[model samples]
Target: MGRLIRPDGLAVGERVRFDGQVRLVLAVTGRSVTLSDIGGTPRAVPPALLFANGDFEVVDSSGRMPLPPVSLLETLPQAALERALWWEGHILEVLNGLPPDAEAGTEPKPQYAPSRSL
Candidate 1:
């Protein structure tokens, strides 16, 4: 668990719930975090609201690469880009763990219940 002082340490593209709706981190600055919906519409988000529900990581975003390259993140201010990239790599490291060859999404699939004959 992360502290509010660090704003939950969320990385871009990591799954998180805000107001009960899942959102993606488009950008993060020293002061605020930017979130986007599936439609890519962005909104200014405060760090305090990010973890208020203790609902960080509602879904494991580790399977896929999250967020756009810094080049495509035109919405972010120039100064925040480098830091965002650094944070992005750091988050991936933590989520990925120590095994370099480990598969990203290895969670066992759920088995469906067999249907009974009517």
Candidate 2:
């Protein structure tokens, strides 16, 4: 097998194939890549599970995944801070909810859903 691609080099939304199935790259780390399953929950996987040559595509949302406009971030009232905190907390909850063996054969729970509005 060829050397695995480092997860840091990948951008969110990139599509990659492994074990004859297709999954989207959701996040990256020095030693592993996180992929979104059919329900959109991210699962971290080691580089060893990734193949070198398979169908891959970068999932660009164009402006859909655009950075939060500075104007919006600046105009928020003090109360909005709570909303931001809530959002961050939700993200952490999702991350924490993932199975430790998500990549090893423990399938993701069907009740989990990826946060698309983030």
The candidate maximizing lDDT is 1
Per-prediction count of colliding residue pairs? 0, 0
Model 1: lDDT of residue 67: 54
Error of 2 at 101 (Å): 40
Task: Give the residue spans of candidate 2 off by over 4 A.
Answer: 1-8, 52-118
Task: Return the TM-score for candidate 1, rounded to 2 decimals.
Answer: 0.43
lDDT of 2 by residue, 5-112 (tens): 534356554566665566666676667778766644567876555645353334343322212334544658878855765565454445544433345544434455
Model 1 ranges off by over 4 Å: 1-8, 53-58, 67-118
Q: Model 2, 57: alpha-carbon shift in Å?
A: 7.5
- Candidate 1, residues 1-118, lDDT tens digits: the string is 3544333356666666666677767677767778776555688776666655455444545654565645566678877887877676655555554223447765422331123221
